[model samples]
Each structure stands twice: as structure tokens, then as C-alpha cells.
Target: MLNLSDIFAPSNQISNIEVNKESAKINHSLNVNVSVDCVVIGFDDKELNVLLIKRLQAGDEKAYSPYKLPGSPIYMDESLDDAAKRVLVDCTGLKYVSLEQFRAYGEIDRLRRAEDVQWLERTHGLASTPERIVSISYIAFVRQKKFRQLTETYQATWMPVSKLDDIDLAFDHRQIITDAIRKIRRDVEVQPSIVFEILPRKFTMLQLRAVYETIHGEKLDIRNFHKKMTNLKYIVQLDELEKDVPHRAAHLYKFDRVVYKRLRGSI
Candidate 1:
């Protein structure tokens, strides 16, 4: 468990504090409740995936496990960016993530789902809540190698993006993820893809193409892709090949981020 004293206040300062709700309201006049949600995407060899957490069903101990995106209400003094990072770390044991604010969801009943309302009430001791919840959603990409390290300390599991259609996610996360991926696709078209976030520092052209195809859900013509990549001039070929593959080894290449940023600016 996270120590609230360590995160919110020093023990010496808060040792005998007995601030009630009325006193807290008088001390800090802010009344809005906000949260941060993360759609953490990663790529492995063959597919694009999102990380989800397993939660116990409210009032049901032995029922099928319910899954949801990792998130939490923002702390009183936390920045939205820091709240996103804190939620990710508290839920998934992931830290130092590269997160971008992709969208804000503030529908009057974003928490209208029975499970959502019930879970919040049960977990947080809320009753007859009437205020709307505003969630600042963020998107982050993790390289497969880095993801492996995070999974060691987390119970979250990665599910393929393609399979989300059959999964029942809590809250409006399905829509959140849909919007996030749409933005990513648009960015991929014009900007240097942050897809490199899910790739290694060095990899083959085929590996690079695989990442794009998996996320875009389309097959790129091999000849056209190779031609376009070469023409881009930002992908640098390294004088190295795969070490132990049974098939013919493909030459390795790495994206020159400096060149990509420069070309993107000109475009």
C-alpha cells in the first residue's frame, strides 16, 4: 500500500492533524473531482496490445475477474501529467513512461454504468454522488523489452488491440482507446511515428514494417514500403545482421530521430 503521509504530507507535519471534510473544504476551496486514465499500448512480434488491469467484481469475490484501464482520481496537488504517471505506477508498477494527453471525457454520466458506480461507491465509501467525473485520458507506448521489465511487478495483462471487440471493458474505456488509436493513426500519417517507442533501438526493416502493419491493420506492399522507406532518408542501415536466425538474415536499420524531426518540420 502507498503511504499517504509520504506522498501527501510529511509524517511530522501531519502527525496529529484531524482535519474533517468541513475543515478541508474551508482550507482548500477546490471542489471538482478529476481523474487520469491511461491507454498503455505496446507491440510484440506480431501484434499491437493494450495493458489492462484485473479487478475483483464489486461484492463478488469468486465471480469472473473484471478488467479496466489503469487509472485513479487525481490527488489534490498533483498535475494531470503527474497524476497519469502516478496512476500508471500505482496500478502497473510502470514509471518514467512517455505519456501524452490524447483526450478528455466529461460526459455527465461517464460513470453511469452500474459496475462503475458500484465499484466506486464500494471502494471509496461514496454515497449518492452527484458530481460529474472529468477524466483526462493519456496514451503511452512501451517498447516490448521495457514492457517485460514492468510486467515483472504488475498483475496487468496485455490484450491484443484487435481482440478488444470481444472484450467487455469497464467504463467508457473502449471509446477512449478507439479515440486514442485514431489519433495515433493520424499522427503516423504525417509525424515521425512514436511507434519507435514499441521497438528496439536497432531492428530490421521488416521488423519496422511489421510494427506499422500491426497497428494500421493493413498489409503494405513489400516493394512499395521498401521504396518509400529508402526515399525517406531518415532510416539508417547498420552494418549488422541477425545473429542466430535459421532463415536468411535481414540487415538491421534504426530510425535517425534527428533526421525525422527535421523532415517532419519541412513537411
Candidate 2:
């Protein structure tokens, strides 16, 4: 058994993580041909955030803050989707979240960082590493409210995508995040309901507008946005108002999934 005290620096920084006793064990029989990486982004009503794990360098506990996407080398008998789901469940205790397999990244220098490569080799106990490890990446955006507290058994935590430039990331994880953001931006354009996935069941028009503005990286005219929302019959207005907020409490609204499904079927 690996000594957690010596291998890990004592950290209280909680995310989808705590570097606790629940650290995963290596499956000696992993598929060397391909691995799966997952990028789960969340929206906190104001800023968009991405889930990231602190990857410690092998034999160097002092070098902390090397965050990376929560991922894994696929088990010998597991499907790519299964592996992606496993990564999320292991790292964040999240299940039943929708994830899209965006694209494959196979650049030869994708794992050029020595510490990153070392972490992988040691974590997985790979005596013989693969010459070329192609990554199958998946992406999703979840509601921030779902993860308000530090989960007990999970591995990374939410980091605002805007602050991504401020930290040290491992491997091509930064590029993966950039690509994931681009994919989601385009997805929301094609399907507006994707926005509701990260929003609370009850929300305000301003909250709705902010999600779009942040995702698209621009300011949307409020009047025009409200007008557009009025046309979207699936968005139902509720009698409740935002509670305890300092600002004027705006009327609450919720998405009608039944109506949305009906309308979407017609289209």
C-alpha cells in the first residue's frame, strides 16, 4: 500500500476532491490502446467553471496545484462510455449526468510534461507505458448548486474557467478544456434546452440571460432576450420570487420538460 502521508501534501482545499483514504486503486489490467478523459464544466449563475483534480508529481509531494481533468485508463473490458462515467463517479460521486464524446486527441506530444507522464505511470502502476496513448474526451455542463459542498469521496473541484489561465495544469488538459468550452457553446446554439441543464429547477430571467451571455462570451440585450424567452413556450413562469437576495426579487421561472419534449418532437 502507498503511504498517503508521504505521497500527498496535507490539503484542505476541497473540490470534487480531498485526497482522502478513498483514493482509487490501480487495476493492473488496463487497456493500453486508449484512455478516456472527461471535462465536466458547471455554471454558478455568474461564471462558468470547470471540474479539475490536483495531480501530485510522483515522489515530489511539495509540487502541488498541478490540476488536471478527472480521467482514467480504460479497464480491459470496459467501453469508452463506461470509462467516462467511471471517471466522473470516482472523482465527483456524480452519476446519471449526460456527457457527449466530443473528439479524440492524439497529438504525439500531448503528454510531453514529465511530471504529468510520471503521475500517470505511477498512479496506474504501469511498468511498461504505451508508446502512443490516444485520449477519447467527453464533456458536460452541470448545475453548480448540485455541488455546493465539498463531496466526501470525490477528487477534483470546480474552478472558474475564467481563472484557468491562473493555475498550473497537466498535459493537454488545458487544451481539452478550451475545446470542451467551444463544443458546448456550439451545442447551446443548436439546442437551447442545454442551458437549463446547468440551471436550477426554479430560476429568474436574469439568471437565464447570464448563462447565455457567459457561454457566448458577450452581453445580450435584456429586452430582446426577454422577448425571445417569451416566445419559448416551454419556459414557464412561476409565482415564487427569489428569496433573501439584496436586489429586487425577480419572479421565478422553470422549464417545462414535458412541453419542451413535445415542442422538440414537432421540430
Candidate 3:
């Protein structure tokens, strides 16, 4: 739906990044066909958000509006895990993000679309785009407020998951996001501690319940939720209260990882 030529062009910043990549190489560098894509999920009180990127400008070309998950071709010198981390930092300007590899996406017709193929050819300057690209995907659910420093070679934006219908994403990124959400749901079921990864260090009980309700897509009974939370020995109540809020301050609670691990060991 967007012009490919307009969306991608030779840029100064990219050349800088290339220099950094080359600095590590002593000889001619060879790259594998694998690429790394990251799905960074964040939670607001009411809904979930996803970190997406789009071209900053098309220069003279007509800029497109569609976005893509932050990713890039992996370096031969780096492991997949290291590639995920490096690509995230290079593409998204996120200094740190702890990612877990969840899936590998490589369809026979992965680069069948004209826009996608053109994107590959333009950005990577491939004379002939590869027929297939194996995407090693990584995911992370982290506190949004903690990582506000996000910018891609293009630009990064946090869009809500519920409103994803509003814009377009390149390639099979939509499917990738769905898979990440599905995995998060399954992992939360097996280990409730996974939910804490998305939350702040100190949180309110209502805020905790909100995260649960948003993930499950249903309202929870407040009484039952509170009662069950009381049994979480690792959820330590604190004297601290939420500051500068419109409503009454609620006492905060912190997760005790040591207690949680010890309890898990005993059980």
C-alpha cells in the first residue's frame, strides 16, 4: 500500500552503524541468511502495547505509513541470542532488553510480497532479494516507563495491541505478534512469576489485578483476587503508598524473588 522506494534510502546513520559492525571484523565479513525480529510488549493499566518502527522519512520519495517490528540481518560472528540483543539495540536504540527466543518463522513464500522484496533490496542493497528469509524471533515483556529511550534508524512507536487494526505492518509481523501473545499467555499459566516481568518493582494490588484482567481479557472478582494474592508469600506488603495520584493512595507491594525461589524449591 506504500511506495517502497520512498520508504527506504541510503542514509548517513545507517553508514555509521555499518562502521560499528565492520570494526569488529578483521577480514571480509560474510553474513548468514538468518534475521532477528523482536516483539517488545508493554502493559498500560487498561491494555497491552507493542513496540513498532517505521521510516523516519522517505526523503524525496513518498513515505509509507506501515510499520515493522525492530529487526535486522544477523551477523555471522554473533550467536542468535547475541544477534537478538545487538539487533535490538542497533535498530531500536534500546540499550538493554532481556529477550527470550520463542519461535522461528520461515515460510517458503516469506518474501513473496512486492513491498517486502523491495524493502529487502533497498535496505540491504541486495541485487536480488533472497527467496526465503528465516526470522529468528525474540520477545520481551517489560515495564514501559522504564525504557522510554526508544528510537530506530527510522523511528519507534508504542501502539496499543487492541488498536492494531488502525495501521499496517509489513510481512508476517501480525502473525508473529499473535504468537508472542499466545506464548505469554501459556507461560503465565505455568509460572505466574512471568507476569512480574511486565510490572514495576513496586505495584498496587489493583494494578496487579488489572494486568491479569487485561491479559485474560476478562474482569476478575476483586474479593477473590485479593484473597488469592494474600497467599502469595513472595508478594511483600510495603509501607510506601502511591504518590501524586487523583484518588486515595494504595499501599504498594514488592515481589521478593529470594522468597519466591526458596518457596519454589521447597515445593
Candidate 4:
């Protein structure tokens, strides 16, 4: 027969054990959780564009507000690149896009919420608090015509990249877009493959020059730009020319896949 004090003391010990277990969990959550977001860039009407989707709130079936970059949580089993591809395709009906992971944003308190603890609890269903969220951002170049707005619930639209500052976005998407734009500009200088994303299947040298100038935000010397392209030797002269132009018809050119692949490695 145990004394009352001993029985009560054991109950107290069990309570302490449970408390310790919970504390351990809270302490162990120091690692930042990973997520993925994509910056889908396209070129249309001689301007750079980005894909955006309006965010929807829980239980607000009819409430859609503020455009944001298409993104989602990374699954445990999927690779970051795979997760990005999945999210882009699932959200926008685009596939086989050339994507590159640009950077990770792991700033604490990046997410804004009305009720901090309650928001996490309701959204993620975590038993304890999450320490940090690290989002991996990717940039992909897609043709404007390739994307189809698949989900009506979340309105997806392509806005010109130059007008990004004019719109409001959720989370750190604005920063992500800025970074992606910088990356695109850098690639334009070194990798000629990026031109394929903006130019039509068959384009004139002047049109290609226009793409470079548009992305660089500066005018390129027509002769020098043409000379550089000729040196690269990847553009094939097509037996076609622009029609109904006020000026002389410029010779149209197509990107040679074999030469592009060889130059891709060099770039």
C-alpha cells in the first residue's frame, strides 16, 4: 500500500514528464522549414512579364485578394526543383519550363498574420511554434502563349515586369521578383539561350536586338549587336522575311538547336 504523498508525488512526476516532452519539442524546432516559390517570366508585346496568382483565405470561398507569386509548401519527399515544377504546372498549366533556383529567403517574422500563434496553428496545424520558414525561389522563362489559366478560384495573370512596383503582393514576393529580374539581366549578358524565351520561334535580327535592349533596359548598337551574334554562330538565316513593313524587309533567323546546345555549355 502506497502512502497518499507517494501516490500524489508520482502523479506530479508524470505531469513533469509530459511538460518536459512538450518543451523538448518546442526547443527542437529551431531549424528553418523549407518552401518553394517560382517567378515565371514571359515576354509578350515586346515587354517582360511575370505570372501572379491571387491568394485565397480559409473559409472565405468567395474572397480573393492581392496577387502573389505562384508558390506552395515543399513536400517532404519531393526535391526542391521537382516541387517548383509541380507547383508551377499545377497552378498555371505550364510544363517543361527552364527554371533555376535563385535564392533562399529565411528571414524570421516574414509572414504577416492577424493572430501570430493562432495563424500558424490553424494553417500548419503544428503542435508547437515554428521557428522559421525558409523559402527557395526559382526563376523560369516561358513563352506567354504557353501558359493557360487553369484554376478559376485563384485568378492568375501575367503582369509586365517593369510594372511590378505598381502592384501589391503578399509575403516577400516583391523582393523575389526584384531578384529574379536581376538574374535575368545577368543571364542576358552571358547566356544567349535566354533570348529564346523572349523571341518568337522565327525572328529577325532587329527583333532579337530589341529583346536584348528591352531586358538590359538600354539601347544596343545595332552593328555591334549583330556582329556579336554573328560571332556566336547559333542563329540560322531562314528563307523568310517580315512582310507589310514600312521599312525594308529584314531577314528572319531561327535559333539552331545544335549550336545553341554547344554554346549553352560555353556560357
Predicted candidate 1 versus true structure: per-residue lDDT over 7-108, tens digit per residue: 333211321113355556322211136778999888886788888886655458643326778877665555899878877887787777898998899998
Least lDDT summed over 10 consecutive residues: which range in candidate 1?
A: 8-17
lDDT of 4 at 19: 28
State the local distance difference test value for candidate 2.
0.77
What is the Cα-based TM-score of model 2? Answer: 0.79
For candidate 3, give the lDDT.
0.77
Q: Supply candidate 3's per-residue lDDT for 104.
A: 97
What's each prediction's TM-score? 0.81, 0.79, 0.83, 0.71
- Candidates sorted by TM-score, best first: 3, 1, 2, 4
lDDT string, candidate 2, 40-81, tens digits: 888988989998876644467665346888887776446899
**Each candidate: RMSD:** 6.5, 7.4, 6.0, 10.1
**Total residue pair clashes for candidate 1:** 0
Clashing pairs in 3: none
Answer with 1 or 3, whichever has the higher TM-score: 3
**Model 3 lDDT per residue over 1-267, tens place:** 432223332221232245564566532132426788999988866678899988433462444436889877665567889888987787778867889897999988777778776676556665555568899999998778888887656678788988888787888888899989888778888788987877788999998998898787689999999989978999989989999999999989998888988888753
Question: Model 4: residues >4 Å from true position, as ranges?
Answer: 1-32, 58-65, 112-131, 221-232, 243-248, 257-267
Task: State each model's CA lDDT, in order.
Answer: 0.72, 0.77, 0.77, 0.69
Q: Mark the regions of model 2 whose C-alpha exceeds 4 Å error after superposition.
A: 1-28, 62-65, 149-155, 257-267
- After superposing all C-alphas onto the true structure, candidate 4 shows an RMSD in angstroms of 10.1
